[model samples]
Target: MRLMLVEDDDHVAAALTAVLSRHGFAVTHCRSGAEALQAMLPDDRAPFDVVLLDLGLPDTDGFEVCGRIRKVSTTPVIMVTARSDVRSRIHGLNLGADDYVVKPYDTGELLARIHAVARRTTPGTPDPADPVPGSDVLRLGAVTVELTTRQVNVGGAAVPLTRKEFDLLALLAGRPGVVFRREQIISEVWRTSWEGTGRTLEVHVASLRAKLRTPALIETVRGVGYRLVPPAAA
Candidate 1:
């Protein structure tokens, strides 16, 4: 995966770039907000898979950079900073950060989060529950999920879904009326055993419901997990 590392500190950026490079990620190191923006221009033919942003920068605040990037690209942004306050985390997320990682985080966890976000944002990668060759489409009521093309439509109109959202929907849609455990969804979709991922799952589910405008399409089985309710059943 190609990753943009926006950190003003040379030593820190170098260390992270090396680590991520060893993990098979092509890292583009930027020392300031301006440099990061410049690298993200349309002229820069190489597209980035994810962005690792630091709150401290020489030219402008990281939040401002994040907001600006959101205006131009839907590339997932993960804020890597020392600001551990809840407000800071909330504010970063509000500014379009997909995930916030505090400084002094475990390297393993960081790698996991990187893979997690990339899985949700990269559509080219095949989904685990890849549909059969001839049966690449699943329809649940007004919702239609084209597995091969990674397209979702509702009521004959297209519905945009984040990578994670599509994975979750596809997983459940594969087995309509069967409740998938929360842990199973996290492991399958997020590719993590981290329990904290449960909250992220809930957030994705809520967002999916709002976007699809078919809340009844995904039925939540309290204490268990969720299932797709076919239109006939609904």
Candidate 2:
């Protein structure tokens, strides 16, 4: 598979090139963010299956690079970074990145992640409970959801959502206009390890409305959690 390798360091790039090449992948390595952007938008460069992006770049930060790419592309991205913070990884994931790998990683694990990330790029398989024409997949106007893959698309364009965002949408979309209490959603969707406040659910809901391109679908019941119906696309 053709993969875009965007990293600023020479040694890391070289090592990745050799390792990835040995795995039968055609790697197009770019050192600078400018070069990476240019390569992605090249008139002749066909879309690569996946991007292995480093967070640190000489020309520009990879986070900004990723944000720019999301404005036009849905090609899967697996971010490679030296930052060990979970929040940083979560931020990248929120910006539409499919996965995150830290520095000093294993080549085999990276390749495995790439392969797993590839399978998720296209999710059409049906689950037992979904309705026909993707009823098993959730449908709310412009939003078409793949419950199995946890991917959400608005107006046929994929939306960059974190795992929690996807879960919140799935729960609400399952029952249109059902007012779930914040605690209920937290208990049901999050199960355990919910470190944020009741307001955190609101934060996620607010974020969903902002990114969803529609504010009417998820309605607030005043002291209730949230509800979902077909998005008012018009």
Scored by TM-score, the top model is 1
TM-score of each: 0.55, 0.52
lDDT tens per residue, model 1, 1-234? 679999999999898887676555789999999999999998746689899999999889999999999999989899999999999999999999999999988765676687778778777643334443357898887888999899999899999899999999988887666566676678788878746787898999999999999889888878757877878988
Determine the backbone clash count of candidate 2.
Answer: 3
Stretches of candidate 2 exceeding 4 Å from the true structure: 122-234
The TM-score measured for candidate 1 stands at 0.55
**Model 2: lDDT of residue 99:** 93
Tell me, what's the RMSD of every candidate?
Answer: 13.5, 16.6
Candidate 2 worst ten-residue window by lDDT: 125-134
State the lDDT at 86 in candidate 2. Answer: 86
Screening candidate 1 with a backbone cut-off below 3 angstroms (N, C-alpha, C), the clashing residue pairs are 120-163
Q: Per-residue lDDT tens digits of candidate 2, residues 124-172? A: 4222112344356877888888887788899999998998888888877
lDDT of 1 at 97: 96
